[model samples]
Target: MDDTSRIGAAPRRAGDDVIQVHARLRSMILDCTLEPGSKVTQAELSRLTDAGRTPLREALRMLQQEGLVKAELNKRITIAAFDLDKLDCTYAYRISIEAAAIRVTASLLSTAEFDELDRTLVDMGEAIERRDRDEFEGPHRRFHQMLVSHVQEGARARMAIDADWAERVRRFVMQGDQHSLARADAEHREILEACRARDGVRASRLLASHLARSAFYVAAQLEPTYDTILTRTALRMVLGDELAQTAK
Candidate 1:
């Protein structure tokens, strides 16, 4: 039997191999290691992730479900093209993911986790001060991931499953928008303060607005009209009375 049919014949780590390959592939897809909208073959993936073709194909199938890749007419895989038009919705979705995570897990997070979170934020601040995107990106992602990790394993996994895409987009935006990065850092500090106080409501609201601001800013870089109405509606709901007061 080939590797595919022989997986059951192999040890349990064969299944584990599929998962590891999938994670690496997902990271590559999001980090632009594979390049956006570029074609990738199974052989390429096998070589890249150092897995057998069977597990590589398994990883590819999972990625395809996430909308990160698709089979071409020639049977090659194409990295899913990013639609700039979706910026507003992408922004709003990220807010929802983060807001839900914070609300559900704020009280559950251990004090030590909070300290680690604070340290991560401080690292981000230092990276920002030094103008090091590489440094900032790592801590920034860890901060968000740790924020979600306070919840149940399943909840955290679900929250993080699609995060690679957001990371990729953020890298794109941060590369050219230092002003926005500064604003984001200030917002993050506010968020950390709210979390430190154990005020879930304030933390959630601030997070929504903070995310909305980034979404709108990035969307505005595009046509400014595409997905504007939907994003604004979502943000207002997140902002609640604050949005109305701002309008007046």
Candidate 2:
């Protein structure tokens, strides 16, 4: 099926329609189809998503809360512009929260949770082998989510949103040599091993370093001189000064 047709296909229920529309719109923004910093009216979005005003408005409102779009004065909405500073801070927030959460969560993972994580790793490996980022994304998110499953509800919700935002920044800012898929998989394995050993400190340090390096790599691509100081600071806070310095 064509992209527009697929995105615009109506759902059976009104609530489903809103969710479908939201996912479609979010995908478009993240895929850069609705290019960053571009401005469009409600009418344009309605036609683009082939969604009615009610569902489209609801979807836009959701995206607005996620900081993916900005509602303007004349019913226009601007796609959130890509910013290096924002990207840095996003990773910083993620590093701090996930590292802290994993410290408590790692020792608590059950056999079923470990099995689920193992399956996700296998799925991620298959996706990587196929060079299918869309496929890889699901398992990747699941891997992270499962690690922090025991975290408090509010922080867990924030992590979910941050995951989407992190994916958006990676799509928008990272390219070419900035990517290290192989190393990423390796890091995932190491982190998993640490969790398996019930070594929360090791897992937390590994996760912080993994997240920090990703942010620093992306920042380097955008501006070689750009320092993701916030990310570094977060890593240090999680891993401490000596370990953080050697985390790279």
Candidate 3:
């Protein structure tokens, strides 16, 4: 079906409608097409997605729960801002969860799965060589996901949430420097090699360190962009305040 007809057309099932709307909205947010902290009007969203109010609202609610949208006091909903504090917390939480998941999954990976992961790493290398940012992100995510796929189902779900948060943070970081692109490629290579050796502990440690490095780099880049509330919040939290305050 055409794009217009597809968005307007209702899903075959009620449950599927919610999922489809949520996925589309989430994509817009991650890609910065909707942008952070931008107001979202139900009428406007309905027109944009060509979906009805009910499904749009349902989708917005789901995004809110996922921390991608903020439901304000006056019943207004907007795309959530990139909160450094929350992002920092998420990084910490994810490192713990994903590291554990990867460790467990390493023990369970089959020869075929290992081969697939190796291929994904190869794809990531090519994407980096060509500086294909969009292509790089897909294989980058897949490589990390493969590391944890053999874990318990529940653990994989939790890791997926972590993966989503990481992607958002990566997009933000990419806005500042191309150097991070190279660093990310190198980190993926290290992670894959560790996993291939079945060294769960080493793999987990490397993954955590890799994520921490990315978080630090992004937090550094955000210094000059901090607003008053964010500045104060960073101060109270003793995180990025000094750099933010000095930023011109």
Which candidate has the highest TM-score of all? Answer: 2
lDDT of 2 by residue, 188-241 (tens): 999999999999999999999888876887677668898888998998999889
lDDT of 3 by residue, 49-140 (tens): 77667787788888888888987676567888877777677776766677787788877788998888888878878887887767888888
The alpha-carbon lDDT assigned to residue 184 of candidate 2 equals 77
- Weakest 10 consecutive residues of candidate 2 by summed lDDT: 170-179
Name every residue pair that clashes in candidate 1.
Answer: none
| C-alpha local distance difference test of each model | 0.73, 0.85, 0.73
Higher-ranked by TM-score: 2 or 3: 2
RMSD score of candidate 1 (Å):
6.9
Candidate 2 RMSD computed on C-alpha atoms after optimal superposition onto the true structure:
6.0
lDDT tens digits by residue: candidate 1, 54-76: 78778888888878899766658
> Which 10-residue span in candidate 1 carries the lowest summed lDDT?
7-16
